[model samples]
Target: MEHILHVTLPEATARAGKEIDQLTVIMDMQGLGLKHLSPSWLSLVGEAVTVIESNYPEVLGACFVINAPPLFSRLYSLVKPLLSKATQEKVQVLDSNYPETLLQHCDAESLPAVYGGSLIDPDGDPSCPSRICWAGPVPDSQINQSKQPHAPPPVIRVALSRSASAQSLGSSEQFSVVEVARGGQRDIPVGFLPVGVELSWCVVVFAKSFLSCL
Candidate 1:
């Protein structure tokens, strides 16, 4: 949130000749969990919305939310009342097949390859890690406990492996980063080796999560 208000807004402003300009926002809600619906979380969203509407009204050109689950609609319902009519009109919930829709507003060269764009990271990463800041997992200790415990909040839950990162163990192996949609799973094909031959794989769930499986 701080990054969006401080860094993103400033960059967009400068790009628009130092005046506030319309900006497009694309959010990947791939790993949204039940914790996101808590009152504490919702209030933080309310706070951000308040700041944006009060200070930067009509700054959004369009806001695209890709890879969003059905539960996201419920979350939006709670937030709908907070948004002005113009801002509400700008919000769009899209499926994983958002690349084609987004291409209508942006050129393929202007976007990263992960979003069906031609621009790929120099390190061969399609997700373009250098251009986008991927979020690391948050720790339980850092989580804010709800202060208004008496107030009831709607319940929701989801758990699905959306993607995986693989490390090449052999010189002949080629690998690249890819994003999987919610409720979608990616299969990494492993070739059959002779009885005398050995094969190895290094799968990283996420760098910050420190989870891996062979």
Candidate 2:
């Protein structure tokens, strides 16, 4: 980060000879999973995001977070409040259709074919292993095994008043997925929830599993 701020930025700006130019930042979080939510990993990521947004607000032209998985929202929310409003406005979280959107901002040749662009690796690898590094899931060797396995938090039943925006009328809410091991069951006590309240949820299970909403 220090090298990028002092050396990379200066050299790139000088080569381009454009005072108004800015760098485009792209973050792809396709394979991020529960394992990444470790305290140490989260702290490091939060600090980096806060520092870049706070210090180099002007250096970034725009930020595109593409191929965002379901858990990305929860992770992003942790750091979103720390960023300035200007930085927030520059960020766009996109789904699978981001390839077309990215092409609109830059030339096809500028991007690698792996991301729906014309650029290709000399060795015919679409991901361009020679030029760009692709990050994979963390190996067991690096993960901290000290995390205490705690039960998932129970959901709160939010009863809507007449003035309250109807859940149907409101936009979709982001919910995190909880994993249940074999022969294990987790309960979300909502039997007493008022009639007016609606509960929306999703569950992800491994092979040969079932869910009982009751």
Candidate 3:
């Protein structure tokens, strides 16, 4: 049976110590969840790839869902000082993109894909108010040949709700969310929105075969 694991950073932290307790709770919950879902399945929360490897060695690849802003703010402080002013400005602009940028850094091909929606009142129909992203069937041959660490499994799909948006991107209808392949050349329509609503972007990732033990 295939396993699905979702990892979320629940708190914003400027220091490692501040995150320890949250991390511990997350890990414990993960273990409990795994026990309930067990036999061949496991799941865990990880703040970084290394943490995932060390703590949940049996897990498949992880889906990182970051909601806090301070995490990036702290990251910017570490690197911005080394870059030129223009470069710094560009980085800031990109930084404002938030969770989308973080997911993209994990894998270039991640796109905005919707996973769930709510039914509008009165008519009791459905409407998508979130963006989704996913990548899958990652290339094994390429992974084996790369000098960098093996890539995670393809993200089949990830949906971000309207509440997740960092800022108003204008009316939701104005921005149509679609899937873009790596290199940003192709687009596949996934969902739609009304004339004035926007959604937080999300990424779907795929896990490598070896990482699938969990």
Every candidate's lDDT: 0.71, 0.70, 0.34
- Cand. 1 Cα-lDDT: 0.71
- How many clashes (backbone atoms < 3 Å, residues ≥3 apart in a chain or on different chains) does model 1 have? 0
TM-score of each: 0.57, 0.58, 0.17
Which candidate's TM-score is highest?
A: 2
- List model 1 lDDT by residue over 23-128, tens digit each: 7889888878786688888889999888888878766889999999888888889888888999999999987679998998777976888898898888889988
Off by over 4 Å in 1: 1-20, 138-214
What C-alpha lDDT, on a 0 to 100 scale, does residue 81 get in candidate 2?
Answer: 88
Over 4 Å off in model 2, which ranges? 10-20, 137-214
What's the lDDT for candidate 2?
0.70
TM-score quality measure for candidate 1: 0.57
As for TM-score, the candidate ahead, 1 or 2, is 2
lDDT, model 2, position 48: 88
lDDT of 2 by residue, 1-214 (tens): 6676778778877875865347777798878899989999989988888788667678888889988888989988998888888888999997788889889876788678878888878878787778677898568998768779855555444322222233333342433234455666666554665434556654433233542332
Ranking by TM-score: 2, 1, 3
